[model samples]
Target chain A: MSVTAAFPSRARAWLRGLLAGPLALLTALLTMMGGALWLPEGAAGLDHLVVPVVFFPMLWAGWFLYACLDPRLLRGFAVVGGAALLQLGLILVHLMAAKGAVT
Target chain B: MIKLPKQQTQSLLAVHGWSGVLLGLLLYAVICTGVAAVFAKEISDWSSPLSRPSGQELPTGFDAAYRDLARQVDPLFLHEVFLFPTAGGRWNVLFHVDEKDAKGQPVERGTEFELDPKTLKPLARRDGLLDEIADQRRSNAVADFLVDLHVRLHLPNPWGLLLTGTLGLMMMVAAVSGLFLHRHLFKEIFTLRRRGGLLTARDVHVVAGAWNLPFAFLLAFTGSFFSFATTIGVPAMAMVAFNGDIEAATAALTAKKLPEDPSPVTPANLDALFADARQRGGARVGFVSLEHWGRADARATVQLEAREGGLLNTAYLYSLASGEFIREQPFLGHVPSTGNSLVLLMSPLHFGNFAGVVSKSVWFALGFAGAYVTLTGMLLWTRRRQEQRSWRIMDRAVHLVGYGLPLALAVAPYAYFLLRDRGPHPADTQGVLFLAVAATLIVCAAVADDLTRYRRRLLAATGVALAGLPLARLASGGIGWSAAWQQGLASLLAVELALFVAGALYLRLALRRSATDEATPAAGPAMQA
Candidate 1:
């Protein structure tokens, strides 16, 4: 195969690898962190924190499988990246609000 | 079976095989060690037992020892105290204060005392950071070595944990993919061909893999939880929730809140509390934690083993001053909730210690099957591509690790038994010897003309090492079999006999393989696989 013909396929493969590996991990972690903010704090006021940590493996696995199995690479990127950004934004907002209240 | 399109099936197969090929060796090591680690307590008892059997019941005079140690240590170190049993039912009392180190990381600076459960006499004492003190331990070195290898492959913290956790993820991928890849998973579970060829090799691997899928998934998920809960999860969660204070985050999740009254109040007798906990829990106390000792706000939490047939542990909270039972404690939080229940389930599920020896035995066998599937899968993968020189070399590397690891592990106990007393720390000595044997095996594998001979030699060596371990123990002051039988040291006898039998079986198989090799060199690839 010519270089130009091979380039797109190789690039797509590398992108898929990145999405399935590191990007998926980042999304899982961010989701876990954000869970403490959104998840209900049960009677003990720790359900949100404890539950997310406990279910971390499942969350990571889910994201990883979706990343690997999804045919539309752009959709995979959008869903994972969008969820990660959403959580990151929520975390920053929570921190900022807490800081404002403190100030 | 769950049906999927051809393209997806191919993707799943690729993921399954490549994941095994990439991380299978380390995963196999983890699973192999984990099989032995199921009997860690038995191994500890077998390696180092007291003259008399120390039952689960906490020995008397424990309070007196605690009081003596309390008076001896600085009051600052009395912020918290932990009491648990260690090798051979010895009481390990650690009085420590949690403090930040120079780098602002949490460290427990403590004085540890190991006491004889029978006499309550201090066998050893060390003062330092908790990790450092643990490094100096000897009595349970062999068990600790195996558990450490299973958990982290003996690498340094964070890195070792991360690597193992990643391996757990890989295992999760492999299990999930294998499940999706197999169209006849149900049939394969019961289908094993006796025909001696590649077909039988594939059948064995598939059968074992199919039967072991759920267990593999369970182990992988729980193992990953344990590995990452502290390393990544706790730290990241702490960063968000507790301003990077892991201790504070841990306290919020696990610790019970009691009103502060710092005025000195005499603590209640530990023996009475232990007995009460035993009666209430219907099991022996496995761990005890004392917070704000000798103060009005002091609390003692007694964690007991799972009740007669239960899967979850029982923990009871007590007021240290009055010695009155406060409540039946959940693992996390004060009351039982979804989170606490899930967290409580993790330990028994992962360790398989809830049902005692029977459960542990089942878990060990399943883990062994998992290891077998992993090894056979890799061998078959290599065998299929053996026409290439690189694949042939991969075959040798696989054999070296697959057989050499067991050989090294079988030989490790020799160092522990020999140097356990009147020598350098047995844990360190075991590491050195394990590495030495592994190095030697690597060289042997490199120089060997035939892979079959090298594999058989390793098997024979492993057999000899295992068979001789009991002798080494007996020679190095271990109790005799007669004494063990008389004293009802069933665990010791069982472990020793198991080792000997396993060793003898390996020797027999090696000899048989040698005969087969002589009769027809490379007659059956199934045998090699």
Candidate 2:
């Protein structure tokens, strides 16, 4: 490994660590909140609320483990960030619809 | 063995070691306190026993007592009423109304009464905000102290809950990574080297960690769910779905609704309802809640204990006006669902109270092993880095918390017994004493020449404190062993005997360690590395 090549690799490693630690945490939290909006309510009409609340820990743990173990750093970032964005969009749409209904 | 790529295995190993190294001490504290807290109910009863053990938590005349308490509470605060059993077989009743505070935040103000279950006589009364009343309870001071330390480490509010929840997440990471890192799981479960050093210690940590991985994962998942559910989940859901109206979100989630019928109506026979609930559920009634108590829209919910050999309890709803059994209801919603079942499983899995003493004993042993894994992992990690100054400081801290925390916890019951009658706020006094002892131990840990001496002294102190707790209880108006036996207080007697035996065991261990230290000079502080 040449010095010039090693520098970029080290920088990428640092970026991966940052993404796996804090960004992963933020993504999990957003996903949980967004899941409450987007998830289907089961026959009892409580899956939307109860499922997210009960399995929040599992959701976070899964994300954390995946974030740390992914071999490609950019792919990990794209997946986590894209999931977070999707959830955020769902939540925003729901809130907008609710506000429109009220108005 | 489950095979994995080398690089992925190394990644998991780093995650495992770093997670344990970073949060290991706090996790150990939480697990150690949690082991004691698994028997929190029995501890409460043992520490603060009534004159005689009541046959049932709620006796026959509880209806009359409820009516009497109802008359004393303000009519404006009659929206909801709670009746439950507290420590020492005391019945606690709270009448409250939820209203917005000055800052548009929800708060509950109520009048609470603690009654002796045997006679239904009022033992203590408080009228104030619900949180204040909760802070003033003293009967279960010792158990509450242990539980609070486990739950939040006595830190305040959402921050404490968040910190503990993070610790739970870290524990989950450690357990999961440990499972993958140890490719020889089955083999390691039976592997223990007799050579006493880092290798032996490493083997023990791996074996215990591997054996406890599934349980640790379950505990971590459930514990974090509990910590975050109220602190973050509900509020965040409310923010998204209900426009931040927590009360509305709660009502919608519970699926309970009653039309506003303010006509004053006498409640139907509560004793009959209790009897029917007990017969139907085949369990003791643990809690009773009535909403709109004096109105035509009144509804009463009776929560029963877990039936024998069952993990979940059943709740029944009744019309307070007609005294008719409405239906059986799940805990979270109007009907049972997968979500409700999962939520129900969390409590038993985390607390290990599903099968009474047998389950609790199993939980205690497993939790102790979890604590051991945490402490040993930290000791091993720091021992490897003994050359680094920061790691050396951390080594001392590991010893301070590992040995010192148990001593402080053992001494708290003493403070509880000694100050119960002599002080105005025994709980607060107990907290101060707990901190004082911890501070003293920290100083001792720093001043002592080596880890061995510090550990020995702390263990000896813990042994003395634990052994003398029963005498302190006896001196502070508690019943003696003879009276306990005569009255069939077997649980209380067992607890006292267990404490004495544990104390003796700890003292013996400390003495043996001290003798070994004297015989082998090389085994003193050098062994820590």
Candidate 3:
């Protein structure tokens, strides 16, 4: 575990961290976009739920991941990350109860 | 083509160059004047004598004064007009009387009267400070010219929107590419070393562009969104999803789904609703919407939400009539989880109209910075290929449009203030001012250029026109600039003074540069080439 040896790995890690941000936002954008053909069928209620049910949770999760991936932004970002997953889970449950497509 | 080791910088330069040229001249007008437009209301008030009194009224009986506003407003228009307890509300209230024409909605004539809220009397108005030099009535003439210019570079509407929208995309692409190209994202943060002439200018473009990338992104994104909402977004959304159901799509985007049921009889008192909203909101009731204003299902809901401390945030709305409070549906805040929240945050983020004075100021500063980034990029673009054969024509076009733009902006406020006294209505004043400024810009674009022979003449003409603004003020018998100032005409005075100062500086620099460039053959080749 020489400091000199660790330097290359640290640089690799930092590079990886920087790339993660854009990747997260991209993933979120894709997930939201993926719901294009996802117009709720029989129940008109599903329509109201489209943005709230599908779009937001992905965006939140993406932003959360984006935040946490930054080492300097690590401290509170982890809590936000955990909350992001929690929110996603809760949103999924809400969507299911509302009879979303995934359900 | 010159090759450089930094592939990314070249890419960024290309992106920056294209985007800048594509939208620069027009956006410069928008930014140059928007620097003043941020304080538009103040500038208007300052330039227009009709809005205020000769002296500030004591606040001792302010509530009584506000109540008096009821008398002046025809009960129907009251909903449209609000009296500021102070000078700082969004806009001043004057009853704009609408005269009906044949088979159409009543045409709004002009501001008929300034209602003294305390007395409810239409005050005997004169063009105060704003008009002492420039017309307050046409204040937006200054801003609107820039806005129209920015969004569409004085091109026709469709063309303007298309160009600006393209520029917006360019801006976004530039930002992304810029971020990608900068390997040392923060290491070069303090790398600005101001050098001679072009290099100094280049450094400025780089530092400002890099440091303000986020702000640039947000401003451009919002700007593009704004222009696109009308030009592209609404149309695209309508065609693709709703089969040109613009109204339905707009309703979804704007209005929270309200019930068809009426809430007339037992509906709560509208006045009481505001008090209740304020009580709930604590700080201020930012928005109030009535579900069924005169109907029974009208549950006046008010939000007791907190200030959104970060981006993509806002949450607060109240019932207009019943003083009943409502929760936001969901999905509004940066932390959107509901419908109510979704709608609430839209405006704040879109307009950057929230978060107190500091936020608005920051938005204003960044907005102009975004505008500068666009302008400097245009200069760099023209300068980059100055040695090429065809570039002379292009350079002339860019510079002609560039320098003349700020002149257009300077002329607009003057147009506004100058025409204010003569126009019967505010609308007429606005119309006259806009027509004058736009006509001038087109004419300038047509005749003006950056010819080495005609350089002094062109700059001198622009400078003279700018300097004439002060003379125009005095010639109009400005109720005396001193009198205008004494009458609490600070806004009018301040803006006019700034305009004059800018005009003087422009004249000085233009004259000096023209003379200096003419004297030295060595400097001549460099500048011209």
Candidate 4:
């Protein structure tokens, strides 16, 4: 491989690693925090809180593994970033509703 | 085995190695202490035993003793009360009220009575804030030291919990990526090459890692859940649901609800309620908590030990005013559900206390192996890069922590025994001693010429320290072996004997390592990668 060709490849690899490492972690955290709001409470009314807390590790692990194994870096970013944004939106919506109710 | 694309497999291999290399030392520390802490209850009993076993955690006259103590406690702090067995089979009765401190932080100011279960007489009394009173408990100092190290590495508040939780996640990542990287998993499980250097070491690492992969994953998942659930999950949920009111969030999850009826009314006979709970649950009661005692809405909750071969225990609720039995409920919620069941399962799966001593022994061995794999994995990584100056520094660190942590842990109990009766704050003294030993080890690691020699010497010191523990205990007014035997304190004697045997084994290994001339570099040039 020529040096010129390898430079671009190396840069791309660095970018992919960043996305898969820290960005993936942020995505998992956002999803967990927001997913709790949308998840349905079971008959006992505690599932929404208890289930997410108990399975947070698996949630993060799945996202982390997926971020690493995905062949296309762009797709990984799109999927992870999209999920994060969706959850963030849900959280904002809930906060807005709560504020309105308080007012 | 599952097959993956070549590129994907390589990616996972990098993930596995980097994850292990990054947090491997801290994870090893956690696992090592955790293995010892699996028998923390036994350690407490062995270190500080009553004249007799007390035979039961909560004795028959507990109700009377509790009532007497309740009469003496100030009514201002009687909003809640708890009765549980503490170290050395002593029953602790705590009456407290949650009040905001000067900084507006919620804290429990309470009175605690340590009563001898056999005699139903108060052995000690403490009145202060809950945290301050907790610091004065010296009987369980040794076990608490080990558990605190394992759970949080002695870091304060959420930081220690956060670090251990992150280590748990790192272990999970390593386990998952390892599963993917090893294509011939079953074939490697039985393979151990007889080569004398890195080949043999790599083989051992692979075999042990392969065999422990599932258990490692299970423990990591459950352990992280326990750490994060308190530090992050509850508060985050509270923020979203209760506008950051933790108390309200806890009440919702715990299913605590009562109509406001604080009218003065004497509570009914707690003895009858205790017997009813035991009869209904078909298990021994482990803990009892009464809310709003001596009030019209007083409620008592009794937690029971799980029955033989059962995974879950029943918690009975009673109306203390009428002495009527309420419905039995699960630990977390008012009714049995999947979420409650999963949360309940996490304790036994992580602690391995589901089946008593047998299960605990298995967990201890497996946890020890997990710790071994972590140490060797780091050593292999560092040894492969030992030529680089930075990597050489890391190599020294790996050796220091790998051998020095066990030495520090072995030294802590000595401090506990020596300072327990002589001081008011033995736990603090023990902590300081632990840090001093660790610092000394680090300095020794820096000065030593041969890393291998340093490891051996440290191991031998640990062995000597462990062997001397029982003598120290006996010298410090503990029960002698003959007395322990006559009193049927078999568990205490067994722990003493086990520590002696373990010490002897470590000494033997260290001596054998000293006799060997194969102190060659950990990994050969070809293995460097």
lDDT of each: 0.87, 0.85, 0.49, 0.85
What lDDT would candidate 2 get against the real structure?
0.85
Candidate with top lDDT is 1
The digit string of per-residue lDDT tens for model 4 on B1-529 reads: 8899999998898889889988888999999999999999899998888877776557676778788889998997789988887777888888999999999988999999988888989998989999988976777888998999999998997999999999999999999999989889999999877654434667878898999999999999999998899998888888877888888888888865657689988898888888888888788788888989989999999998887788776788888889888777677778777788989899889999878999999999999989988988888788887678788778888888988999999988887787788865766887888899999998988887778778778889999988999998998889989988999988899999999998998898678762332332332232211
Q: What is candidate 3's local distance difference test score?
A: 0.49
Predicted model with the maximum DockQ: 2
The sequence of per-residue lDDT tens digits that candidate 3 reaches over residues B1-529 is: 2233564355445544554566566556655654555555454444444434523221234334434543544443332322222232222343333346677644543222344433444444322222231234343344454444555666777877766654655566566556656656576556766333333555666677778888666555555555554654445334433446666656555555545554345445545555544554454443333343334444443333344454443233444444445554333221234433443444455456566456667877777676666656765676667788566556666555555555545555555556655745444454456566556655654554334434444456567666676567666555457776665666667656766676666667567864435332212233333
Residues A31-85, candidate 3: write the lDDT tens digits.
Answer: 3433322434222232442342223333433353334333333433344445445
Worst 10 residues of 2 chain A by lDDT: A1-10
Worst 10-residue lDDT window for candidate 2 chain B reads B520-529
Better of 1 and 3 by lDDT: 1
TM-score of each: 0.95, 0.95, 0.62, 0.95
Measured against the true two-chain complex, the DockQ scores of the candidates, in the order shown, are: 0.66, 0.71, 0.03, 0.69
Binned by DockQ into CAPRI classes (incorrect, acceptable, medium, high), candidate 3 is: incorrect
Q: Write the per-residue lDDT of candidate 2 for residues B134-232, one digit (tens) a residue.
A: 988888889999999999999998888998999999999999998888998999999977643434667878888888999999999999998999998
- Stretches > 4 Å off in candidate 3: A1-103, B1-13, B49-142, B151-162, B181-189, B192-199, B234-244, B253-269, B282-293, B297-322, B328-361, B421-497, B511-529
Tens digit of per-residue lDDT, candidate 1, span B253-367: 8778778899999999989998999988789889999988889989899999899799999999999999999998888888878888888899889889989999999999999
Clashing pairs in 4: none
Query: Ignoring the other chain, what TM-score does chain B have in each prediction?
Result: 0.95, 0.95, 0.68, 0.96
The stretch of ten residues in a row with the least summed lDDT in candidate 1 chain B is B520-529
